[model samples]
Target: MKNKPAFATMEALAAVLIIGFLIVIFILFIHPPKQFADARNVRRTSNVGTILTALNQYIIDNGAGPPGVDGIWRVLGTADSGCNINCAKKIPTGIEAAGCLDLTPYLVPKYLLNIPSDPKLGKPEITYYAVRQTINGRIEVLSCGLESNQ
Candidate 1:
């Protein structure tokens, strides 16, 4: 009789442990928390679109594209990026060494209040590259439906 009770107690403990594990799994599936990875991707993508639109508006208001590479000329002057805070060194074009320019300066006259940042990009900064175009063979604001992986 003593042995029978001991065996039953062990069985009950095992059953309880199994049930607890199943419950944990169920909870995880039922209310999935936002993944930082996915969140960062969404933010980065959306920000790219938003900034692109702002660039367009800025250009429409102004005559030409912002100075320097990637409209980053704003960084040298102590102005705001309007999308987010970017003290970016100029994006290189064909390995030109003097190509150090911050991309924020192009969106002038309040293009954006604050720059959108990628959550996963090590410091909540944008990691996408800009595509610049020329109007009548003159450089203008940035453009990007498909950007580079910088």
Candidate 2:
């Protein structure tokens, strides 16, 4: 009878409501697949680490590491674009005197392919904070953890 049609309508409405609820849940719990900056921060830190190692090596071999402005820019294959031209023979202005010293100058190496810029913050604006220390008489570079706040 008429009741049957009413029940059918209610069923459809209920189904629609359920679908809407699920959609809300999906939006709340299921994030769109995207590479967030937090995920890319690891790579940035690793690149920083690599640069630190290279600088340490440079110091060990030359009796002095690259200039300590922000730190040292990586000079790829002796290109002299980053630290080579700027700091190899002389020092460059890097960082506010109190800010994290720029490290891009000492990262250059004959085998290093290129300067690994931060993927999240992009080049020249490296948001990662760093600190230099001598651990057990060895130069150690420390960086802010996942949040880059160090």
Residues 3-26 of candidate 2: C-alpha lDDT, one tens digit per residue: 445457779999999999999988
Q: For candidate 1, report its TM-score.
A: 0.48
TM-scores for all predictions: 0.48, 0.48
**What are the per-residue Cα lDDT tens digits for candidate 1 across 1-150?**
335455578799999999999999877865444454445556656766776677667667876555553422221222223322232433323222223234465664388655544444322132333435444533332212122332
C-alpha lDDT (0 to 100) for residue 20 of candidate 2:
100
Candidate 2 regions exceeding 4 Å error are 1-19, 30-35, 69-105, 109-111, 125-137, 142-150
Task: Give the local distance difference test score of model 1.
Answer: 0.46
Lowest lDDT sum, 10 consecutive residues, model 1, at: 141-150
